[model samples]
Target: MTDKRIIKSSKVLVTGGAGFIGSNLVDRLLEQGNQVVCLDNFATGKRENLDLALQNKNFTLVEGDIRNYEDCVRAVKGCDYVLHQAALGSVPRSIKDPITSTDVNIGGFVKMLFAAKEEGVKRFVYAASSSTYGDSTNMPKVEDIIGNPLSPYAITKYANEVYAQNFTDTYGIETIGLRYFNVFGRRQDPNGAYAAVIPKFVMQLMAHESPIINGDGTFSRDFTYIENVIQANQLAAIVSYDNIKELQVGSKSVFNVAYGERTDLNQLFNILKKNLSEFDYKISDVNVIYGENRAGDIPHSLANIDKGKNILGYNPEYCIQRGLEEACKWYWENL
Candidate 1:
């Protein structure tokens, strides 16, 4: 059995705790007997995400924005571990409003780092992105090799890694960045224009609406499950400390949190459609409109998870199909 007791009694602060990934992380932390403080502005996150955690005695929900220094300071104070999951995600959203994305993703991230460092937190584990691979056409992207960021959102995420390294080198903060692939599971919003593809497609299919497939439907992704991401965050938070730096705390270094597998959009759609068809036989031939290709999206993305496996003992439990099935079920019932 996994040692879920590692974080017991630890006062942890999770920014964006009301968001999908952040709320999930908060749930896990509360389950482990940790005193979790959730700070979210709710720009994109919903209050419903933290409903379960609110019932826990150890969980405290703070409505605040990370961009504000006072809020960051208040949230970071007395926290043992800081899991920074707050950010404005989505490339197209960033492309449409680069300033808002920059202010929140980059500016807010830096503010959190400063506050965490000042508060003398034990460790900082943050959500990085596979989008950092940017224009690199490599089949399996490695951490050391990266390409120029194709979009403003990618640039902010990449800047986070650089800032983390800088904090380690200069301020002596302990930090680890988990580069997540296309993560999907329950609680992912499906109604927004900036919604992720999996939830968006599942919602459309369930609503008996046409799901638009961007590009040729051949574009692939290493769609990771939300549970795997929660596992990675826990591992990153409590890894044995060896050479602790001001920026990085744990014994293990940065790692790619993914299943190390590829699944194209076409295959993904078919899997979800087939699974949902069990409920409604006549749901076949749901119109799939292939529109113009997205600007910041990479043609394909696959991660080499050897680093995570060796360092954090990270093992992903679900593949794209399994994750999509669960996600589709949630959308069918909820959305």
Candidate 2:
């Protein structure tokens, strides 16, 4: 990991800093007393998410798009590290418009990489996705084994891993890719058609509305919390630049950031129902309505976080139930 001392002293640029995970990372980095510059175009990222960070003197928000090389350059200048969190997310959204998704996720990622490279950013960490494990049907997905992408969103993220390797091999720039699995927590938008399941369900229960399960409720995922993701980013940014070279040269070169366990929709529903019941007893009676399965969703997704554990010294502090309980409290007050 880059030295903790160096990370604290560093000025890091977080692309997509107004989005769910990015905004949370900005909060944590600012808490650590690091100068954080957030670059976002307010596409998927909401301005309200950065409210508290905006009040911090050390925080800077650049309203920009990564797809534009000049915007990428503006965001990268004078930064010690670059955390690439900006991307067009959601499988259904990508399916609706693959071209736009490709332009943002893949095209924008390359632009930021090049910008960081030119600016001599010490380390580059990006948000990779578990969807890249596409169609593999593998339980407890390991980093090395991956299958053909099932959606345009998956294709873009897989391309990111390949490109990160090439960037490291060809340009000698240090890069780290964290393949996130079902991340959720505070500031996670639950309103959109492409909202994440946990927050979406929480908001539904808050309104006493029935949440529709996309299948028989057997589909499962390793629902990681936002804090764990923030921890992974901090660790990724703190690695010694030399260690990054060794990792890029040696291992599978990508790490899965997750809870290393899976929870099916039925279990998730039960967990949310149980926790939210503390606020309203009627929530306990909210029935789930099952529907047709999503076209591109995997039956189950579990991450083998051995790489993150052994390499990054990561031990996720929140399990599913704990994360759910905390998220429930946040949604109860905020939603």
Which candidate leads the pack in TM-score? 2
Residue 4 Cα positional deviation in candidate 1, in Å, after optimal superposition: 4.4
Candidate 2 regions off by >4 Å? Answer: 1-6, 241-251
Candidate closest to the true structure, highest lDDT: 2
lDDT per residue for candidate 1 within 1-335, as digits (tens), equals: 16452567799999999999999889988987889999999999999998899899888888899999999999887999999999999999999999999999999999999999999998899999999889887769877677889999999999898898788668888888999998899999988789898888877877778888889899999999998898888888887645333223332356799999999988888888898887777667686778889887899999999877767778888887778778777777876
Models, CA RMSD each: 2.5, 2.1
Q: Model 2: clashing residue pairs?
A: 1-238, 1-239, 1-240, 2-238, 2-239, 2-240
lDDT per residue for candidate 2 within 1-335, as digits (tens), equals 23342358689999999999999889888988999999999988999999999999999989989999999999888999999999999999999999999999999999999999999988899999999999997777988778888999999999998898899889988888999999999889998889999989999998999999999999999999987888888788775656445554333567899999889999999999999999999999999999999988888999999888877877788898888888889988988
Give all candidates' CA lDDT scores: 0.86, 0.89
For every model shown, what is its TM-score relative to the native structure? Answer: 0.95, 0.96
Worst 10 residues of 2 by lDDT: 243-252
